[model samples]
Target chain A: MLNYLARRLVLALITCAAISVLTFVIIRLPPGDFVDAYIANLASNGSMVSAEQAVAMRHEYGLDRPVVVQYALWMGRVVRGDFGVSMMWRRPVTEVIGDRLWLTMAISVSALFLTWTIALPIGIYSAVRQYSIGDYIATLLGFMGLAIPNFLLALILMYAGFRYLGLSVGGLFSSDYAQEAWSLAKFWDLMKHIPLPACVLALAGTAQLIRIMRANLLDELRKPYVVSARAKGLSELHVVLKYPVRAALNPFASSIAYLFPYLVSGSIIVSLVLGLPTVGPLLLQALVAQDMFLAGTIVLLLGIMTVIGTLISDLLLMWIEPRIRLRGRA
Target chain B: MVEQVMTNPGAIESGGHMLSVRDLAVEFGQDRGSVRALDGISLDLRAGRVLGVVGESGCGKSVTARAILGILDRPGRLVGGRVLLDPGTSAEQNLAALDPNGAALRAVRGGRIGLIFQEPMTALSVHYTVGNQIIEAIRAHKTLSKAAARAATVELLREVGIPRPELRIDAYPFQLSGGLRQRVGIAMALACAPDILIADEPTTALDVTTQAQILALLRRLQRDKGIALMLITHDMGVIAQMADDVAVMYLGRIVEFAPVRRLFAAPRHPYTRALLRSVPDIRAVPRARLATIGGTVPHPGARPTGCAFHPRCQEMIAGRCETTAPSPVPAGLEGASCFHAESVVQEAVV
Candidate 1:
């Protein structure tokens, strides 16, 4: 078991190395550097600077160095709590994304739990009661959830918020976040604003989970073991819940191996609409502004989160399914 | 003295029979598109002896068991039939027509009729421990407290002859070996003191030695509990060892049904004859080349008209064999369907 974990960790490191290299190369691919962004912003203010001054700024920021040197330097510092400065936010990348990371994790994971809690019972019920009116209705609902894309659902809900509830759509944290420090009152206030966007984000993720879980349960219901369970004179509820449902959960739970990492990607669309300061929007801004240092760090961070999430899930799978652990040890 | 009447079907049981399936036909989907998994099948399983239904793949042996258990899903319809089971004391009920999760059938199934599946572990839940699952099953049928359910489960596991049943009650299905898992399956099935146990290829997935052990265990249990055994398998050897009577099914129809000795020693139907000939008996030392039944079990959509087995029947009797399906002809024990039974017997004995 220890050897297996060691092997997995080595593979994880290789994966992280690949991701870091890709992030470094991809972030630098665009034409302009930080100088161009500064020049363009200052030009709009009618301020002109000499080519020498530009050269001086480039050298100061270490942008004058070769791409590989810059990548190595930034990665080295990043490993020690220093993600380069964000050109747009004019702050450290970690400081900018730190609190937002918590918010995103809360929204996404909670939505995931809600999705499973709802989907499991409904999926099993519909599958066992297949061809009945309830089954038809549940299937119809699943179809509707699938058809109406999550982002579109978010837009519709936001539109409703504007029209009916008169709720503010200014992406969770108010405009004055640059001035205020983190506080309990501010956190609750942030959550209050987080609801619509979080829900919108959850809609797609929850829908995906519901559909997958339903499929899993339906497949399980068809297994020979389920038939035997029913023959054992078990109640319909017990049979579905106990025998079929567990076998069905095998595939679904294994996918949980990637769920948290996918959660980072899942938050991208909703985060864009809400403008809640998360890595998604931060990564986007860094790309557009040609902030290579900041972009590389954020991408690396996200990659790390994804890798870590998958690893933890893999370890959890052993506890969740004793079969895997026993097989491994044996 | 009891075997006198040649024409009349001798009921397998001296006491009241547990399950009597009469003319059961399972057609999946529409008429033209429908699959006849079991066509006009009739049989009886008494309170004790194991009545084995042996056949090749897709011969409707498993379908017959599923129909009794009320587990057949959509696309597999029980078109016509009556699965009459005497619920110990209640009125005889036809399990065929009961809804998949209907109240009355639920009372009969898992309540009166227990089933052991081909793959035992897959049928047991992975999320639940084997002990808790059986306890829940016991609680499902009767009013048993948690402690009582646990006690019943331990005792039931012991009854199935699991080693250190009390210690192993907490073990999950995947933790146990294949043979032990099968024992758990049996224990779960017998929790309700069911009168009939339908074991569909119970030993098909086990090792040969484990298979023998399970067969022995089942026989002993049947004797002790007086529970009927409707064993379904494709292995003719298993049928020969365990079955009191044997039914040979071909393309969803019971082509031959008789006492095991008679069916094996002097087979009647062509399909049955081919099946017996194919099996290499160690008893026959200088064995003739084992007969091979040509062609696979045809899909439900393409089953030939009239006789479903005629396309492959070696004893094709002019137009009658291919054009008009032969029905069961009453012989020594009960049912055996074939046009040239007398001639086949004559050839076999000579």
Candidate 2:
């Protein structure tokens, strides 16, 4: 088990390196330059700086160096917690991404909870009472979720909120976030804005989850042990939950490692639709402007998030189920 | 209708019959006319005895076992019958009469009568370790602590003669060999220590040597545990070795039920006689032809009218055998459900 873990850790490091190299290369290949765009923005504003000054500014940001040296320096700074300043926003990339990362985490995590917590039981019930009215209804709902694209769903929800409730799904804190103390009321107001985006994001995911759970449960219901459980005098509920459901959740449970990626990537689509202020928005802006350092940092941060998600999923598997090897105990 | 009281024999005694099944019939559906899975099937499985049910494929051996466990999939059901189990109590309950979702029936399954499925590979969960699956089986019925359940699961793994049970206990079902997996399944079934164990073709999926080992393990467990066993199989040799009482089923009905010795020695049912002759033996006269129960079983959907077996019977009497169904009747200390039970066996000379 130790050997296995060590191998996995080494593989993880290799994966991280591959990701950084890919991100760096991809950012370099994109057309245009942030320095030129900045100089143009300045020129349009009638603040004509000397050519030497513009070159000096570029050098100060180390854009003067070749790609490899710049990457090495950037990697070195990353290792030392000195993520470079944002090219477009002109703020330290870490400070810019930190708060937004936390917000994204909260929203994604909450949305994930809502999806699994509700979908699991519903899917199981649907599978158990399969071909019944309940199943048909769930099936139809699942189809709707699958068919309606995320951006459209978000737009429809946004339009409906205004048309019916006469309310807009925005205004973080409703009095500006600075005045809020992260109090319950402030959080509730914050949550009101989140639903439109979160629901839009979760619709596709929860639909997929329900389908997975239902198909898995349907498969498990046919197992011999399930029959054995029923034969053992256990209640239908107990039989379904204790034996079959636990077993059925195994594949999905293993995939929990990938959920963070699902959350992060899936959030990008919904984030764009909602016009939310998150790392994803900044990421899109950085990419469009070819701000390599800023875009590279976002990609790197996402890589870190992927690692964290995988670790959590692994630990969770060991905790919820003792069958897995944790640091090689068995 | 009479429940268990009228059907079960000698209910008061300790060694009395545990289950008395009578006239149990199962069919697929309406348009797809039901196959007589268990036609007028009557038998007694007493405490502390092994009843090996033997027959060829589609003979309803598995159907009988599934009926007992109440685990039959859809389009298959107990259309008519009674499963009277003693339940180690004075009041023998009619298992058949209970609703599918009844609490009483739930209490009986996996509690009083445990089941061992045919495919051990498919029987245990791939998701959990062997130990966890066994622990789940234990904890499902008993309210043991997680630690206690784990320890008990490991103990059962050891009890089934698995080597390095402590280490291998955490291994998944797929990690074990065929023989070990079967042993694990045995341990799982025996976890509850029920009065009856129904091994539904337990060894059929395994190789011959592994099959022998599994059979021996079951026999040993039966001897030590004093639990009645219903060993379902199509192999006559296995029945010969393991059965105290043997029942021959044909077309979802028990055509003959008797003591293993009596039935094999003086087999009454033509199906049983043909099955016995089909098995190769050194005692057979040289240049003699091997007997075979010629013809396929009738398609379950299009069952022949009257007797379900008449189309295949060699000594088919046009009117009595084909036009009229014969009910179960006594054939010595046993019973054979055939119109010509007496005439067919009277001239029987192997």
Candidate 3:
């Protein structure tokens, strides 16, 4: 087990390294850098800048250095907790994203929990009572959830919330509490504003999870062990819950790698439409505005999360299934 | 609907029957219609006796086992039947009459009756330890503490001839060899000391030496525990060795049933005789081709008009056997479901 953990950690580091290189290269693939965008903006607004001042600015920002050298410098500072600076926001990349990071994580995590808690039972029920009216209804609704776009759902819900409940349907909090620091009332206000966006984000994921879990469980329910378990005089409920359900959980556990990153960067259009302050919208804006430091940091963070999620889920699978652990150990 | 004679209760009871199945019919439904998989099959089992049910593949041997245990898969309906278990009392508990999911049936299932499946690798849940599974079966019918159940499971493992059962207890199903896994299956079935132990093709998946060892272990266990054993297999050798009574089945019905010695000595039914002849003899000339039954068991949907086996029987009566299904008729201590049973024997002698 110690060796396994060490091996996974090394693999995770290599993955992060590859992700960092890719994020850096892909973010720089645009026609110009942040300096060029700034200069163009200045020119478009009919502003003049002296050549000396422009050169000074380039030198200060390390924009005058070679691309490889600039990447090394940025990485060195990143290891020291400095993600360079976002030219668009005129602030350090970390500071610019720090506030949105917590809000995004909160919504994503809540949405994920909601998706699982609802999907698990519904999926099991649908599979166990296959072709029944309840299963048919769940299947229909699952397809609908998968078919309808998250952003469109967000728009529809926002409109419904405003029209029916007279509720403010966008942002993390009401205007008064938006800028407020932590307090019971502000927390409550934030909680009240979370449901619409979280529901929109979770719909597609929950539906997909239901379909996957249902299919997996149905396959497992047909296994001989389940039949023998029933023949052992175990109640139908006990047989389904204890035998096949554990095997069915394999598919769900394996999805964790995609799930963590999905929660972090889900429904970009939905985030934009709902005006929710999440990493999705921020990453989109940074990529569009040629903010290399911000885009690279966000993508690198997502990649790191993916690696860690995979490691955690792998360890979890080994704990739950002895077959995997024994195979790995051997 | 065809009127069928229910098993005679007095005759079975006089034979010391522990469980009696009467006029059992099972049907599997598809889109077009249903086909009877088990048709009007009856048998009597007594404690401490090994009753061998022999048949070719897909001839309803496993189906009979499942029906007795009330574990038939979906779309398999018990159209008519009564599985009566005499629990050392005047009144017999009708398993077929019990609600499949009800408590009474559940109590009878793994408590009074136990089942060991053919494929041990797939029968035991791979995710759990063998001991854990055995303990589960033990606890299913008994109100034992976890520690007690664990001890019992270890004892059972040891009894089934598994070496180092204490260590092997924690091993998963995949960790054990086919024979060891089968031993675990036996241990599980015997956990509750069921009066009737239904082993459905238990050694069919094992190697020859392992199969003999398993058969020896089952015989030893039956001797020690005195449990009624129903060994279902297609191997006549297994039946000859282990069974006190032998039942030959074909096309979803018992073609002949008699004491093992009587069955092999004067096999009355042509199907049973053909089955015996098909077995290659060690003393026979090596170059000679082995005898085989002419045709396969008829498909359930396209069964022969009268006797289901008439098409394949060499002694088939053209006009009579093609138009009417013969009920089981007695010949000495044996019974055969063929109209020309006496003539078939006389013809064989001539």
TM-score per prediction, in order, is 0.84, 0.83, 0.93
**Model 2 bad stretches (over 4 Å):** A36-60, A171-188, A262-266, A311-330, B1-15, B28-36, B87-90, B126-193, B207-210, B213-217, B220-227, B282-299, B304-342, B345-350
Give the TM-score comparing model 2 with the true structure, all chains together.
0.83
Mind giving the per-residue lDDT tens digits that candidate 1 earns over B198-272? 998999999999999999999898877666799999999999999988888887777788889988787878788
lDDT of 1 by residue, A8-123 (tens): 79989999988998988877777788798889878999999789999998998899999889888987887787887876677887777777677667767767776777777777
Arranged by lDDT with the best first, the candidates are 3, 1, 2
lDDT (10s digit) by residue, model 2, range A188-263: 7777777666676777778888899999989889888777556556677877887778877877766877776655
lDDT of each: 0.77, 0.77, 0.85
Off by over 4 Å in 3: A40-57, B1-15, B30-32, B328-333, B342-350
lDDT of 1: 0.77
DockQ, all candidates in order = 0.55, 0.35, 0.70
The CAPRI quality class of candidate 1 comes to: medium
Best candidate (score: lDDT) = 3
Model 2 chain B weakest 10-residue run by lDDT: B1-10
TM-score of chain A of each: 0.89, 0.88, 0.96
Against the true structure, whose TM-score is highest?
Answer: 3
- Candidate 2 local lDDT, B32-107, one digit each (tens): 5555566667777776688988887877887787787676776678888788887446777988888777777766
